[model samples]
Target: MSIKPENINLNKIFIKYLNEKQYSKLQLHYEKLGKTEKQLPAIIFYYACAITLNPSSNIKNLKHAHNLFEMLYVNNRHDLQLLCNMIELSFRTQEFKVVLPYVEEAYKINQSDERLLLGLSKIHLYLANLKESIKYYKILFKINPKSKINRDEFLTSLNYASGITQEYYLSECKNYLKLLETNKDLEDYNFNFKNLKNNKIKIGFLSSDFKTHPVSFFLKGLLLNFNKDKFEISLISNLHKSHYDNITDELKLLTKNWININSLSDSEATNLLRSFELDILIDLCGFFRGNRFQVISNRAAKIQACWLGYNNTTGIKNMDYLIADHNLIKKEEEKLYSEKVLFLPKIWNAMTPSNILPEIQKNNSIFTYASFNNFHKISDDTIDVWSKILNNSNSQIILKNPMPSSIVGEELKLNLLKKFIARGVEKKKILFINRKKDFQDHLGLYNNVDVALDTFPYPGVTTTFDAVLMGVPVLTMKGHNLNSRCGESININLQMQNFIAENKDDYFNKALSLQKEKNILQNFGKNLREKVLKSSLFDTKDFTKSFEKIIQKIISK
Candidate 1:
């Protein structure tokens, strides 16, 4: 082929440089050409794009390359692919906040793309605006009802925000279960391939939260105990390397194989897993919509199961099993789930860094009553119950949540005060602190609290653990669903049942009575910390054994 004078002759040179992964050299080539060639805009743009696609490129080059694309892409309407590429780069670099404006702009330009909705929903959920988060999520859900968004975890998250009674929550689950049962599309999700190996079991664990996430807290012990020699462990992760903590590093060392299928298409993810000869695909993500749940509907693994990370039974028919412990799945409650329940020894083993020892409780003039649950956990009923505790006792209720940046701490405080004032509780008794940071420092900051309080309906498991780890006693009300029952489990294990309440009045009475009895609170705090140190909750070794036995049973089939 003859190169015309205006053609720039950049095609072969750019491709050769990209083929060698020489991004900097390609940039030099683009810069050297300047505006001399008519095709310079396209050539330079593609070369910068090639640099951004390189996995080895750091955030600096990705940003610079993206900026270069922006300069070349003069027509804003024709820049969707480049914008999406930039969004992907920003997401990979842990630049979630930076991606928000781009996503919003993209939605403004083209709101119908499923990929854009997916990206938007994920970011909004991260920001903790559940209502606004759900609005975009539902858009994707409507498109792929059997795909990702309408899964069990998303429904449970919505129910949690609804703040209804335990009966209502159960009723919601039962009603949703009906939809899964009758939906012909969900019924079409069966993957009973004859090629399923009897001897070898392929275990695929999928999740976007493998770091210092709430999901990680419970998964640590299980990941450590999963025997690689007996079963092939394949991890499909959307979480980027920057999200890694010490526990995540431990998971990398433990897993037999790890696949970064974060951005793969549904067919691509399914095909990738099938190529691995997967016998069992475990949806650790449940229905949370982090990574490739649409792949789950395809049944990439022969015997699919779900456990740990999400609390509810995934209503997907292709999901054959829902892994839970005896505590979480009673025979009576089995009807509530679509998938057959595989009961483990305990609900799920939680593993925390051993260094987070409980501090000795010291006397303070003002009794510090605090709960570090997310702001969403603070529903109308939860605030009402909390107000009763503060009203009955002449003490301040200190609330810590990562809400102020989304809204503001003072605004949340004002909202809570309004709730309390409506219930005739004094406004001065409520305190609110809202900020966001890495979990280690965030959990460590709870040492300033005296007695930790657990929210009802949608109670906290990880937050409760974080509070207990700081040697603060948690007062809890055990309700119907697993959400409300976490505090009871922790209290039972810690042998601090005095803090367990049966009703709203009882919860208030206990909080009030405990604050009055300082000596009793002190004695309980010391005893509780000692009990926790001796309990299986903190005993990684014992938890690991239980996890191993369960995996053995599953793979032995």
Candidate 2:
């Protein structure tokens, strides 16, 4: 049935916004349009209400909006984008659950709309549906083969919460490099390195992860080592002051200038960076949430590059270079980036001093297996591997995480434990921990654990660093993707290849062998602390030199 042209007039609705009463009358009239025309009018009415309704009117209006969307039964592309916009706005207003049905519908619609795919992927990740999230990410990657933006976004989001699609991670990395070669803008990324001598190069570091974040953990060492007299360090913080923590406090003291860019408009942030006259702006939080990727698009900084917080190169054209080491990024693998590759001597990650307690060897009665990595990284394959380890060693697994603290945490813990038990790991053997104020006590907790298990597809980076620092050896599986291969990187650098496993049998064999050689394990753990301290991994001074060299080289070009 064709509706009258008067039905969808957007201008007629705008005229009704002269006053509150008129707006209400217009909204009611829009709702009536939904009753007669099943789909199009319903979609239009919801779209209008979603945009026009005030906070006081939002809750009631949102229900009608959602109902309208459901009645529309949208299966087409344009309708899907509109639905995504509706769901995204709902998420902003703490209406997280209300969007799920729409997300489900979106998943069923096309699954190829890059935006829809990513939005739905995020919701699944938020819900801790790791496998489902990976499924959608894989589809998104396949559809946008040339899109570095989609690839980087999918990988970054996957890496942060759960893990990554191992098969896609490496291929995408190579594709990004190929894109970079023809990228003329980044060809002479080394232009201003010689200019480093002309004046102190104004270096700006941008990130939303400046507070109590893993990015901050790795960055602290580099910032502490920067030659403040030679490099003027400016920080573009895309974070609210209310969210500030002790980590931010520490970082604030390290940078030469700190600007809170969260509240500032995009134009405001651009003007502020331009005013600072930044010669080299380093983007630490590449494509991660609240990252201000648009700032790079604006070319606010003269020289922009993506560094260590994220592993893969950002697909953004404006980002000039990606800092990598020889091991993590192979020379043969350089063609997969959107930015020119600048290889460093070793792995880019550097450790810092953060009140870490010394390792205590305890003769706890129970043989404990501990994995401190996040719960999302705990995939079905990972759980199966750990259950095998437990069965082989006759040991209990203690899975400790900072999440699952409150009542919600308890429920999540129970659900996860049940999943593990279903896979053959005894329910009694598994342990879950909620938030702990003094994470320094984690070292003491490690005393109860004889071994620390690593998750694959996305192995632990900082977690491995910490486990080693605390003298707990991590048993890791090497795989094809960069996400899974980091354990091999750690093993190679630490001179502990024996600690790395190639396959399921090798992983189980390594765990069993380590258990038998308690003395060797103890000695290795003690020496791991010494090894990290002596190795390039902990050499902040050298790392700072290497980092500055890259910056100087870029600036001189």
Candidate 3:
């Protein structure tokens, strides 16, 4: 079980490669030591340390590495680090069911360890165990209140697809401000008041989701249609270089001023942005992740606004405006926000789906329901509702999100089936499909779906838009908060007000009714796209014009 005296230095070399993240070097070492009798122990060690950790590892290699890990774990069951590594390896391989035992084993050794706590929280979140995920996050917050990364994760976990109280959400967002002790002395962007009326208003948008995200999808039409002569737009991107793609390049071309603040410190990012001398700065990312709270609180522009990036109010005091529509944020609930509501006339955002969309496919034999939103949004209540719909209608629901192919995917599906089985839904009535990677392929999923059931409290926005675009009717429930009302706004704009439900019971009844109304479904399938195309939601030009006028009005004051 130990290396020979002469080969002891190999262990040090392995540590050096791993510590330095020299994965290639580790791979070379693992390859060099392969299939030798005397080096068998070292080979097994390197398999986990090197092959398992390889970023570009193939499925075969990962499976092999997992097998070696199981062999190693049998004798090293007491080793905490080994258990943690195995847990991580299982994660990489999407074998989430196998990780629980490893996590439990690691927990016995040290419950308060940050890594274990973080891993636990994330896995729970992934599996839609919101209560447990929040429990670990609360524990992490109590352990380290000032940990920015933890706080960001904690904040994101709070805003689930299901709803929370407006007051509670507001309080937590305000508490998020404490993490950034306001550095008010940040150097301000100088304004040329005398020449301002004659110059193009410089508007800067700050966000990490400039790629193929929901934010990017919704912003596409507006970004494309912004009047170049009237507004000088600058994109401040917080996305890392590795994630940059064709969409990023396309977004970059939307404006001449594109800055990457992904790697910079808060002070550095703030100064660089302030250096741009933007007249209006928009916080597209409130607190999801990579949120520059310090910069948001400090000065970087003449006017700062919070928009579609977050579902709730960003508690930054200096955030002057929250871009809204009457459908999104109500006048009575306006008191919950820290900023002035800049209400647009019709809709807050509009979407332009892929120019060449995939043709919708239909299943005539059986009724099919689907949800394409993130798995995190699938609350227990939402699951129960969907189950009821399926049970009543004798239909199936297809979850076309990012579920893996491993035991984790199976377990997640099984976990869902258990919930449905309890509610008297057949396992066969609940279908699970892994998400597609390509945009066309992703949209192609809607072909199998007849009606897309929107998640509650945190209903689908982009997914709702996409389903409507794909000619599938969506059933959504209205909630009090911004996240909950996104579906309501979209449905109203689509002129499909009947699709919007007053409550969970309404949502259920509507879904069953939609399933029963085959003639309506057929007519909807034929005309929904044209309806969306004709609606305000698809009129990018007008949405942009309205957006500009709102900005002009706000800045004029």
Over 1-557, each residue of candidate 3 has an lDDT whose tens digit, in order, gives: 75576567777777788888887777776677656345655556765677776788887777677766766766677655665676667666666777676776676677778777878877787677888888887777678776655566667767783546778777877877776654445444332323244378889999998987878878778888988888988889999999898889988887888999999887788777766777889988987777787887765677899888886787777788998789978889998988888889998888775679887656556888889887667788898888778777768888866433543465566666677788888888877777677878877788788889988767887788888888898888887877678888999888888999888888888888886675745678658887888888788899999999999998788
Note the Cα lDDT for every prediction shown. Answer: 0.66, 0.69, 0.77
Residue by residue across 165-233, what tens digits does model 2's lDDT show?
Answer: 434454554555455444343323333232234378888888898988778888899889999888888
Best by lDDT: 3
True-structure lDDT of candidate 2: 0.69
Kindly give the stretch of ten consecutive residues in candidate 1 with the minimal lDDT sum. Answer: 403-412
Q: lDDT per residue, candidate 1, 1-557, as tens digits?
A: 75665555567778778888887787777767655245555676677777786677776877776666555543564667666666666544445554577678778877788778877775555444455566787787677665523445456566456444545445545545555445344333454566645454567788888776667667666666656566567667877777667867777777778887776766676777777777677777765557455576677776777876776665566778877666555588777677787765643556655565535545556777888777667666777777777766667777777433533323334545676799987767777665557655665556566778787666777777767766677888866655456677777766677888988888878877777665744565556566666776777777766756665676566
On TM-score, the candidate that comes out on top is 3
What's the lDDT of the predicted structure labeled candidate 3? 0.77
Angstrom error of the Cα, residue 315, model 3: value is 1.8
Q: Which model, 1 or 2, shows the larger lDDT?
A: 2
Tell me the RMSD of model 3 versus the true structure.
3.8
Clashes, model 1: 1
